[model samples]
Target chain A: MPKLDFDTINLGHGSGGKLTNQLLDSGVFSVLKNDLLDQRHDGAILELSGKTAFTTDSFVISPVFFPGGDIGELAVNGTVNDLAMCGAIPRYLSLAFILEEGLPMTEFWDILVSIRNACAAAGVSVVTGDTKVVERGKGDKVFVNTTGVGTVHPKAEIDIRRIMPGDKIIVSGQLAAHGMAIMSVREGLEFESQIVSDTQPLNHLVKDLLDEFGNNIKLLRDPTRGGVGTALNEMARDRDLGVHLEQRALPIDPQVAGACELLGLDPLYVANEGLFLAVVSGAAAGAMVGAMQRTDTGRHARIIGEFTDQHPKKVVMTSGIGGQRIVNMLIGEQLPRIC
Target chain B: MPKLDFDTINLGHGSGGKLTNQLLDSGVFSVLKNDLLDQRHDGAILELSGKTAFTTDSFVISPVFFPGGDIGELAVNGTVNDLAMCGAIPRYLSLAFILEEGLPMTEFWDILVSIRNACAAAGVSVVTGDTKVVERGKGDKVFVNTTGVGTVHPKAEIDIRRIMPGDKIIVSGQLAAHGMAIMSVREGLEFESQIVSDTQPLNHLVKDLLDEFGNNIKLLRDPTRGGVGTALNEMARDRDLGVHLEQRALPIDPQVAGACELLGLDPLYVANEGLFLAVVSGAAAGAMVGAMQRTDTGRHARIIGEFTDQHPKKVVMTSGIGGQRIVNMLIGEQLPRIC
Candidate 1:
């Protein structure tokens, strides 16, 4: 095995032969050995019941390794969050890796370990997977796509159709940490304090909300690539409700806010991987925020805004100076590949 | 609409904003206008029952377009075939695209149409999707990852445990056309007759076979990236059964064989898109072959091999010249990125 070991990925590792087996056995399977994936079949078969939630996401962040998380970690958690947003308890995930030739074996191994650890932390299994390698320079170092499958809870009726006016909107935590962290590294900025990506799995937090509220949870959404502003805008447009936010209620870490100000960016439109916005019944808003605050992942939970009948399908924010301003979805990407 | 029109995809198109909506509305949403995808939620909700098969594949095949099909077509059909191989009626797919900055909008639109057409051909809907843009050189023209979800039939009991000695092995069609098609184009070889890829969805053929033989069908698999030889080797290893292939019985197109020889390649190791191998009960083998032959996609189907207890978990090929040789999986990719 030592002599047959590869120092870096080549076309052979993806050939589905001895080399492909070596790579999987030594790197992937060695880290994430589960019954389904270890079956080594083309696909995984499971006995699932009730409604199922399916979601897919491709992670092409510039730096494969980031401040708080790498692309591998983000790939798994992001997909998990998408399923969670639909009130599904994510169970199985299929990972596909596109490895560029010449990517060092150490880096590849590192990402595989990250993926395994993330799946374990999120209480999901890496069930079935594929690996394909391209010629050098034809791709970046590595790109990962994860597709998640989970069973929807019968009591958890979550959708935008139930997003009625007067529903309370809640933000899980501080905003823009994920985006600001990437920007600082890309810009090589020397801030007084370092900003790290807030990349964490939000399924457990969403589970807590669903456990407490059952069908009262109107909707849940994760602000990833396009940030909170875009998410609210989309929810409003789709649900035919207006979102009104109080500037002072939005939670923002002073350091992250300072970094955003330094970079000429608006915090509302910057991505947050660990944070999510939820619309709940007005009667349960107080208890929802209380339950969220009790969780380790949502200590800074705040009622940032609420849905209104006025200005249907639009989002508006009240400024600190008591001025109302329309907050539209960002027409242009302030940051590309922020995911 | 003119001001909001999209000519080419830019950073904004993936920004999840006005431009993203325009691109999705004009291209993705217009073609894949299913209820789940049109819901515009973070994920698609499906009412699935019983055993579910989940599979994922990332298509990074070079030369995005080739003789018979492009990456988009392969993404859909390939996934459909994987799920079908598990005896699952391929139902829904999730498409995620990583587009390089500056990729032409026309090519993007063309690929989307191809994807939609393939989905229609396979009778599966593009339920949910995501699009992301990376800076130029960070990605190839476009890479698509399709994750397919399908439900396993009640009587369709397919598994490796059913594989045993005296079982018959069947091949769906001619081998190596896909690999040779891309190889010819990449090496700039001019052949008297062009070897086009056999890239077609085989869900209907699988359905026909399943209908004919419910639980008698032991196993089904597509011989895609690593060709038939690799696929059989995997099946043998997983099922702990010997696969005895007859060289003279393998259905290889003359042009494809000639091209493989001229290129110093063995057709056994070359990839094929629209082909599969099935192991059925000895009693039902003849009926299975007849059913496959009646289908257009499996018109060239043949009983190329059988299971034997002579050498468990090994694949041996009896050549035309009366010699037995172990047909091991390809140790290295003969044609990388052929998909």
Candidate 2:
């Protein structure tokens, strides 16, 4: 990290004056240096063609720093994952920050480094961005917003319309790890082991899947703030189809499950960051799962459910105790700033 | 405007759950209805080709509502202007919001309407976005981030390398109107007439200029946060060139000038919302000024200065009273959250 002369950021750092330039020069620009961003122009110019995917997300994750990742990593991975879910190759990102005055410069530098590292991990560039500061009491520590653009895969045909009743639903990996991690910190709860946020960029794995499956990969979504239950419920409602799940097949870390159980929260309604749900053709399901298991991030991938014509527009889960129940959309916030 | 069931937004609205969907259905989606955003997908897919400009900005302007504009409009126009300055025809925008819990629904709705109106005026679409609500005191009322993408104008060649010593510098309309307007509200000062913010979209006027002047327009920039003084100083430093200005030629609304004088602020150091400084080829400067004067937003446009090699990397202005002084970049916070 570049040594900053100031101990903390003040309103002057956002004044778009001498202080602002100093902040950018020794801080942001020095770390995230690239030809495009280094130009210091109003925006970055890129050569693009074909179908492009555009998306934006603001990260206000509380605690800023969690076990496995910080808000910087989540900000990059979240937007990159969104483009990946659209079957796009994550290319470039625009990162804007809203910093509260009086935030320690050390904390800000750490976040900038994390952003640079995350961008490298995702193989994307921070092309253009803005910085604004509010009075100390007017804002929390910091908030980051990332907007991403990527080109769609040539062979990918990811759409809800492609999902049929016979399509198989697959979970990429363990669930409830991200939400449980934040909850654990917020509630000061502990288990036998530490629960870490599963915040990782899924672009590489998504590209691999799209290259192999092409049109067979019907839809892809990461269970974020609303979790897997909300994602699945929305899919069912939109497609006018039902989803059938086997509780035994839902892969989750034992610690995360325990934490959720202890808190009376269902694992299915808990958020997952690095994980994703893929809807695939029934014939390709088995092969897809096998392929996913060979990848590092998807070692725990499994087929947890299937789309059905029965009980249209609903999600039915068969529990380990042999009882079935309907899974509805989450009505209220389970945890604020869960990311 | 669509009537909402809730009087104020809560954490649930940002939960990505039932309440979140309801908020979107009744608020965002309803006001900014478009086919791309209505898909409710992870991102919007656009068929874009050739050279594109990308930029992002976060607006944390206090007093969400101001004379002649609001934060929403500023959010949209700010990004749109950034793209315009890059010599691109603004195309699509990604809107993201960080709202505080307990914010009145009416305020949020009015902002949404302003955003919609601004988008229409700029001829851009809000394709994808995200909203995250923080705890009541974790954030101020609201913060907005807009990321915009636009196709570069084929005829334009905007670059500092293209600027020469004899290039003419032009200012579009009055200076310090925006900063003074916000200050008037904050200081509770009354002017002979209302000091309204000169906040409006400049993409149309920019398009017209690019279409006509092409490469003759060496560079374009909006004198926003740091005002014209800071922008020119940066330009001079970047190109290792000097800028010579005639104060008699600087345009300013009389009331705005008086307000700045009373506040002990220099008009050159104040912010502007709907003004720009263009560096054009001296041979085409006269024609460009004539053309700009015919446009609605540029009626007061005039040649204010010229690039020179006399004092390299310096900006010197000659006053109407015949005294000369150096103009430097703004050093400290003039007005925080002035947008």
Residue B97 error, candidate 1, Å: 0.6
> What DockQ would you assign to candidate 1?
0.79
DockQ of each: 0.79, 0.91
Off by over 4 Å in 1: A1-4, B1-4
Candidate 2 residue B111 Cα shift, in angstroms, is: 0.7
Query: All models: lDDT?
Result: 0.87, 0.92
Error of 2 at A9 (Å): 0.6
What would the per-residue lDDT of candidate 2 be over residues B1-339, giving only the tens digit for each residue?
576678889999999989998887775456887888853689999999999999999999888999989999999999999999999999999999999999998899899999999999999999988889999889999999999999999998999988999999999899999999999999999977899999999999999999999999989999898899999999999999999999999999998999988999999989999989999999999999999999889999999999998898999999999999999999989989998
lDDT of 1 by residue, A1-339 (tens): 123256889988777767787776674456778877753688999878888999999988878898999999999999999999989999999999899999988788788889988998999999999898988888889999999989887678886898888899999999999999999999998778788999999998888778778988988899887789989998888888799999999999999999989888999989889999999889999998999898899999999999999999999999988999999887788888887
- Lowest-lDDT window of 10 residues in candidate 1 chain B? B1-10
Q: What residue pairs are clashing in model 1?
A: none
Q: Ten consecutive residues with minimal summed lDDT in candidate 1 chain A?
A: A1-10
Shift of residue A256 alpha carbon in model 2, Å: 0.8
| Candidate 1 Cα deviation (angstroms), residue A1 | 13
